[model samples]
Target: MARNRYSFLVKLPTAIALIAAADQLFLGTAIGSWIGALALGWILALLLSRPALRRRPSLVALAVAAGFTGVLAHAPSLLGWVLFWSALSIAALMPRIGRFDDAWRWGLRLLAHAMTGPLAPLLDGIRLFRARPRRGRPSSSGLAALLVLPLAMTGLFLALFASANPLIARGLTQVSLPSSFSVIFWALVLLVVWPSLRPTRWATRIVARMPSADIELPGLPQATLLLSLILFNAVFALQNGLDLAFLWSGAALPEGVTLADYAHRGAYPLIATALLAGLFVLVALKPGSASAANPAIRRLVVLWVAQNLLLVASSILRTLDYVEAYSLTGFRIAALAWMGLVAIGLVLICWRMLAGRSAAWLINANALMAALALGAASVVDLDASAAAWNVRHAREVGGRGVELDLCYLSWTGPSSLLSLIELERRPLPPRFRDRVRYVRAEVLETLVRRQADWRSWTWRNQRRLDTARRLLGANPPAPAATWPGTHRECDGWIRDDPAPEPAPSVTSESDPVANAVATTTPPLTGTPSR
Candidate 1:
């Protein structure tokens, strides 16, 4: 009873502050600078509501930093929002995040918190109310009954008086009540912010009730494990040997099989294989298992893991070669990062086996690596980087790369605007240069319109616009009178005729240009950036 009362009282002020903050920052306003303030407020509210959090200033600072990173692009992204909020929630709920917590446990706790957080304040209030003693006084239900008649009679008399007097009726008519939407909006704000202000320990309690991870499962027979390791090693070695010849040694692939085919086909599948191998090791060679103890099996496991690392390296090389052949994009960059993580994970698995480290140690190490990657990703704009890379390596720019992929650049939105302007200034064939300018103009128009409203502004886009303006000068190229395709494919290629018609009906459905654009797989649509 005492604890419930204390908890409710302590959190009430913080909850009210958050409600006001949310009302000011989020209600009826576009998301921009408000994101950072709201993020910081959440962290601050957590600290004030939970006294223990105040002592961990470093952790709190980390949460603040992470939350702010989400707004670095001047607008919050899905990833940014996730990192910002998750960092605060994890910091508040998982007290030993850096030291003792693993990803699986952290994820479980977060899931629990999210599921129960919204109802926490209501449940706490109920408990507090129930805990109050009646002691010969009217209980809560009786008190409600006591007020019923006076409230009803006052309402009844007021209605009668309003019926008899025009002035009273007019006053009653002028009295405004909150709209249903307003009530719902406030309720939603309370539901969303109150949970973080008074985070429930129900998640921790649930996690505590989960079964221990130490429960032993039946392990693979030593002989079966040994045979599996040998066969796996042999198969992996064969693949690595082929990669050594075709990828590293520069031996040509068999006729009709281009290097691009080899590189593209192997990159993702190899990572999947490595992941499967990691899972197999976890299940088959857990610490204290017979196969993990056998000298021969240990040797085979190390060799297999080493081969997996080599496979990961091959996959990385494959992706790089593919990127070189095609063009870089955000997804490819993430894939490369994923391959690197897989390599590190394989190393950790080997280390765990060799050093006799616990599974928890390995899981924690990998989780730390993953968290750092996500944190770094939150702050860095990969699309911008990809745009810059493509512009630099573009064949039109005299680099030995593929032709400038204007379609992809357009899909990347304003992030590619400055890059497109740079490409426009580069020495290229006259027609292609015009195409580049057209794309740049469209992107610039979108950017200028977006920046015109301060609500949608971000420093990154503003800087890009400023830089592009400096480069393009007062008179920038205008958008083509017609779009390049039915959709703004921005490929800058249409019929080979002297002049392609207007965008709406320029090309018939059977036109080769239309086919080319339509055939471009994974058709991209949507405003490139917010």
Candidate 2:
């Protein structure tokens, strides 16, 4: 008990110092390599509080590897953040894992620790305060007595001096203190860091209190289960058959239904259906139970699961078609990845049922697949990839894809740098070319200014800056007179009518749209007129 109490005391200052470092590193600047440094600081703070973790060198190494991955990319990803925190949480709980712990229960315990970690510091402070000896004089009132007289005298003198001396009064007024946000930022940092610094040991009880994984619920009756499976298969087969006809085999849709409408509607709802089907199979047909063991039910179950897999495949195809018809975004890419996960999950469920595996095994299998996918996703820049894809296939460049959406690329910020540069190099119509340059210049300027600060610097941005310099030369395009959201569309076409302010009367015959903001708006392919 004393050891646990002392651990918190020892780590409190470290936590405070890290909070200060976080404020310095993050408050004013965009996230960059600073995240790696902050992650490393938290790891060290955790190690300081619990020396035993040093003995588990492999876990320590894994934690360091995952944490550093935050800075490994040009910019940190959501995956990197999740991986960093997850590793720290696992490292904090390493000493608590027992020899007999199974993967599923241990994972649940890890989750419990995460949910309870932020509160652990307050809990510890309460425990320590309660455990102190009662024989000591009331230290709080005595300390207040000793400081109250000095504080009163200092306040009185400061007030008198401020009124008497103009210099003092002006100096007091000039004092620029931290804002309210600083205090909130510090408290938030404490909440994030405290858990890793001192993990709650009792989180084990959360997993302990959970019902045993081995407890089997009564299985559905074999005849009823078999009938359900047959009906489900037939129903799924109908959907799959329609998908095969219209989507796979390219049969024409009904007059009113376009392929995009068909593709968009089924992409997500079908995934939900597959998920619901998997849950039904898991709950109703336990691996070693009578329903699962029966030959007829097993056959029907296999057929239904196979049909579900086909349904998943169709969903994937539909999503791809939707992307081809419209344009790809990060969300669509994620949806595709999700479809893959669902397909993998359905297969794992079937494999578990046939092999007589436990629910724990099935969960562990699915989790492993998800972790692998997230790990891969962490390093790849989905936004950049999407931007680049759109640029490469844009109709402006005479490709089969839709016209480039500069608005989306603008929202994407620096991730669109390379793609914009690519678009600039491609052959385009004169007006389209001007708009492309205008949008590209806006994105590039922001990236350059952001990287100017050390706090916002990242390897990815630096690489892009270097490549851009080589391609476009040291001179960036002149800053557009009007930004995309202001007087122009993201595609850089000028608005039909200018802002309420009068346009400058001076216009050059040689270049009417060159001073677009000062004169008349330019004519472009899709600019709508009032």
Q: Report the number of the highest-TM-score candidate.
A: 2
Where does model 2 exceed 4 Å of error?
57-73, 99-111, 133-179, 213-215, 476-486, 496-530
On a 0 to 100 scale, what is the lDDT of residue 328 in model 2? 85
The digit string of per-residue lDDT tens for model 1 on 1-530 reads 66656777788877777777776666566666556666776676776677666656437645565555546446567777777767667666655333435566767888998899888868876776576545676544566678999999999999999999999999999999978876777778777677666667787888877765455778878889888998999999999999999998889899999877887788888999999999899777887666788999999998999899999999999988988988999989998898889999998988888788887788788988997888777778899899999989988778888977898988788888878877777778887876787778778888898788766677777888889889988987664555343433467654433566557855567698877776675656886876
Query: What TM-score do all the candidates reach, one by one?
Result: 0.82, 0.84
TM-score of 2: 0.84
Off by over 4 Å in 1: 27-29, 57-75, 94-101, 134-182, 288-290, 479-530
Tens digits of per-residue lDDT, candidate 2, 145-203, equal: 78889999998998899999999999989989889999989988888788777777777
Determine which window of 10 residues in candidate 2 has minimal summed lDDT: 132-141
RMSD of each: 11.0, 9.6
